[model samples]
Target: MKRIIYYLTALVFACIHFVSCSDDEVEGTQALSVASFYPTIVMEGTEVTITGTAMGSVKEVVFPGGIAVSNVTCIDDRTLAVTAPAGVSEAESALVLRSENDEVASRQTIRKANPAFLSYQFADKEGAMTGSSMTINGKDLLLVEDVVFTLGDDVVSVNALEMTRKSNTAIKLVVPKDAPIGEGVQMAMSFKNNTSMTLPAIDIQKGSGGGSWVQKEVPVYSGEPVDAGSWSGSVQLAATLFADAKVDDVIRVYISDCGSNPQGSLKNGSTWVGLTDDLEYFNIGDDAANGYYERAITEEMLSQMQESGLIVAGQNYVIQKVSLFTAVWVEGGDEETTDPITPETIMLNDFEDHDGHNSSWDASWTDAEATEFPVDDNGNVYLRLAKPLDGWAINCNHQDIGTVANIENYVIKFDIKIEAGVTGASEAAMQFVLADNWLWVGAGLFPETTDGKWMTVSRNISDLSAELVGDLAIGKASNGLYGGVIPAGVCIDNLRLDPKK
Candidate 1:
């Protein structure tokens, strides 16, 4: 019995010793240590390798800002790898390595990457002229400290006041007037600590013209229209030729309004009287060019001006005189030229002869409540538009008056006024359309005047002859109403087609 008991005790002791050895083998005995890490600076999502002992027991790696790295793998007991978490802060942060039972930290701190260049574009993405507003779209724009434009050796530094940071993705700037004008201009941005890659080339258009040229003012009239018999019969108007004038060079003749008297001294306030057929450039050596051009002044021309408010029949008078100016196009000379005016004034409509009939006037509306016909009070007639819908109200008239045949020689003028408490007032526009040809010209009225006062709007249709060959209709261009934010009521009067002056 004693022998059996001693043997059992020995067996139990042996079993206990074997179990203790197995448990020791399962728990790691190596101490965690970090010798070093590669890439002291790291961008988000970059894989980092740590060379140290007992790395296989690492549970997780923590970066600054509570960012925990995922997909950690232990290559061996001495090397560990993990994908860096997306950095949330711009500052540098210490790295923390956590094991199942211990933790180790690195002395070095990793920082978020600096801004990187991707691409850029103008606000319109098409291009911009100098002095025009432009927008740049790119990444990390918030860190941009300064933007520089480069064209060969010439550089333009944008004024600090000119740049506006709209967002992290967009910056607004005005194309500086001195910015180099050419294709493939380089743009670059500098950050607090780094500079971005230069953007692909961009195009900037030429700005307004700047230069000098010669100007000569030829006398339009030395005497009165009546003295020249221009009021009743054909009159001869002439100007002396310049010595250096070329045969092919252009000579534009203009008439001046010698308010009240023939000998009124030419001054800044002197008005140039424009007549029909005046804007046409006459070759310096052309018809009867014998140092002069003759125009027939008849009763018809005088009557037309009297009817239109251009000249008061008895109170105001037009001299049978014109001023001639000459210009020649040189390879690198100024390209800007002014058109001459000829006086062939005609009154298409004064709203005085409505006669209670639509009488050559038609009212059209879109999303409008009502259209008021021409109302006359003491010879002053006006057309009123009320409750215009999203689209504007237009009062157009078509006449077989042969005006459209030579539309280039004429201009349309009218008085427009916005009524108080009107909606979509700023969105109101004026348009002249030729229905037969479907050609139309329109402009916004709000830009010139914002108050409710009456304002005269004039447009030269000289270049629109091809489009104005059909019956003419004048009204508001169809602009989508701003959800009824603009005034809805307006007044229009004195719609007329007068010879360009």
Candidate 2:
């Protein structure tokens, strides 16, 4: 995440500007005319009103670059109101109002206001945690072409993946951990005119978000695939399966060929005729695809499972392999982008927040939920995609800042929770990519990680050309035939770009 901010080009203000409209009344039987919109300085995306005779006939508003916009609204016969667009070239220019037969021009040179800094707020805390969001408010911020954090001698601009222009008045970015903790840390905004302004220097504080991670995989059972003899019959895993596990540990039961609905209970010493199936009972979703069930170990659950492990009984299901994950949290902190030794990064989407970047895809078919993307009860949203199926492609639009044509030292990071029970439960190819171009990172580039837990996969992308790559895509990477691969409920989240560690 260090030196990660020097690659942005500029932010696009999204429109051609300097058009004006007003609501002043026009007298009857008057020639088609318009009054010069006052306060010639206008902000992008703000309403600009112009009062004119025959405004009811105005069909279009012409902005700078001769960009004609027909989305103007007629407030009344004598008044027209249209949102000001982002002006690219002519700072001060004449705006044209076009009707069916004639054109009316603004009597004044309406100019788009430069981005003016107002104030700034760190995350909802006294000091900003690394990976926490900070917002800067200003006027005409839509015209802010570039934003950088000046930490000491470094002028850092995050790639398009992290920064977001929320509205004309606000832009938000995630704080990086690479800065030395102290004062004189400044945020600067640059505009098209080659001018820039800086906010007041503030104290840079370190946050304790991410930390060192250590993982352990606990296998329950493994064998050739076998079908359940009956819908109500039970398959009992030995108590030793969880003998080495502890309370507060998270375990994922990997059941091979989990046909559809499955149910189970924590038994005491392999009792088939159960005493009572109460709180010990569990249900697996009707999943013809996924083969794993996740659970956090508790005092009572651990005590119950210690006797006979688990008894799973369900209809039409196959049992080939079974395993449990013993995930431990050794909390040093968010070690990836938030550790002091790591480089700075622009956070794309944690899915905890519905980031605008997620919607930047040309066509979003990420998951097939009933109506919308699934947000879990824990507030985690997911890109539930299949392997080698590269449909989860995010555009390389760096918050209107610039492309991600970056140093070879930069890496892309994302969190993937693999359901290893689902036959071919492994990540295929995740790439710093552009469609079927096969131009960037290759297949199996992820770190050696086990399934059933969220593993942060960081892949170096030095192998690709430094051209303006347009997107970052993920797919199964196997084209011809998916022998036994079915990745239905695989989850992806917290994607971003940062300098490689």
Candidate 3:
């Protein structure tokens, strides 16, 4: 009797399974339950497979933007396929599946792919360390407001200011300074309306690796590699990299390290050719300062050099390394505010050593005559600017900070003494220049140094507009206006940025 009952039950279950598979239907009003789905996120018009119990009855798939895809197909009694429709918002929302007499929505959210991050491709295909650069390639990446990395409760973010938006499909970002590290480090991109999605894990390697970016090199032509130390070859710089570089930027093509290596001849991208027909344009001149040939890189050259970079093939010159050095500026304004300054800082440059902690007053723009390092009556050494002559009156000196610079709460201190008889002693001002913005820290902002006496001047940069600076200068760069009031004989000493003590 028991065997007869078991046989009857097995026959009934087999019949129900066959009926459901053949007709793509389930018994009346069966509660649909989702087991799982592959690729919870996808690009529009991409197909997705959903698996669940009683899913054969699904007749349509409704996307977040209300596009009802009625052409859904059932693979079997427990599987269905639907292609995502276009014109849907790229955010997390319910994927509703509709059947003849039932509606089942996924318990987990589904979203359309956006900023579609393809991979963590570094320039060299390796660097994934702090301060090194990595590129995120995808569609509509401009929608990403901030890129975030998190490990447990610790979180670090790199914003748009720190990233270079190469194009609609690519963005380059240097790893943030305080980024969290370890296995299972989660990465996510923040979009508008607080929408975010979990992405593949990123490995933030330990130890020091930022050197790849700080003193990094660019690409060289491939073919016959120039004699390792030979200078008779070509160098190429990507357009997007130096397109925003300012005039007077110096490119040194040398047979040394800390720059790009000379490969073939001066050529565009891959084509072997010069940017212009001028013979002097290809003439790679020698630099006495750094023992390399230097060329003034201007916006015009950049336009032509976008693809091919500069060529150093003049007379079989065996140059090996190439470096592009940019000049940083300091700007100030006439506006002054009254606040008690709590002085603190780190020594940047004394104008005596030309070296400080990660900062230096590079003498590329001047010589010992115009900028003198003289000992005072008390044997105190100081830097002085000689009066402007018939030549360009560039009294202002530009200081170069290393790859890392002191930021907010870190104030720049300058000890200054302006000759009382100078033209604009009463209105004497200092300017800080970065990129295109100019900030002028006028008289009342610091101290009255025009009395012909050295006075310590300090400015808290935390409230300033700029976050990091490449260089700094004593005065403004106005055709010749600054040379008038800031006469030669102005003395400066003890220049540095330090934490407020």
- Leading candidate by TM-score: 2
Off by over 4 Å in 1: 1-361, 365-369, 374-377, 390-392, 396-399, 403-405, 421-423, 435-443, 446-450, 463-486
- TM agreement with the true structure for every prediction: 0.26, 0.34, 0.31
Error of 3 at 431 (Å): 4.7
Return the TM-score for candidate 1, rounded to 2 decimals.
0.26
**Global lDDT for candidate 2?**
0.50
lDDT of 1 by residue, 27-144 (tens): 2767777777755545565567776667766777887677876457654455567766675456777778787678888877765655555545443345766655566666555545
RMSD value for candidate 1: 34.5
Q: Which order, best to worst by TM-score? A: 2, 3, 1
**1-501 per-residue lDDT for model 2 (tens digits):** 111122232212111222333223333455667865543555556567666667766778887667677888664455567776766334777888887667877767766676667888775477655545677877766555566777767666653334532346677656655644667777677654456677777676776762332334444554454465445554677777778676545554444444445554434546553324453455554322233444556667777677766765554555544445443333434422222112145344333211123322322334233112455432335555444344443333322223332234466566656555643344545444422233445446443334455666665555455542323232212111111122455555545557653
Better of 1 and 2 by lDDT: 2
Off by over 4 Å in 2: 1-94, 97-111, 159-161, 192-195, 210-375, 378-416, 419-489, 492-501
lDDT against the true structure, per candidate, is 0.44, 0.50, 0.48
When sorted by lDDT, best at the front, the candidate numbers are: 2, 3, 1
Best prediction by lDDT: 2
- Minimum summed lDDT over a 10-residue window in model 3 is located at 1-10
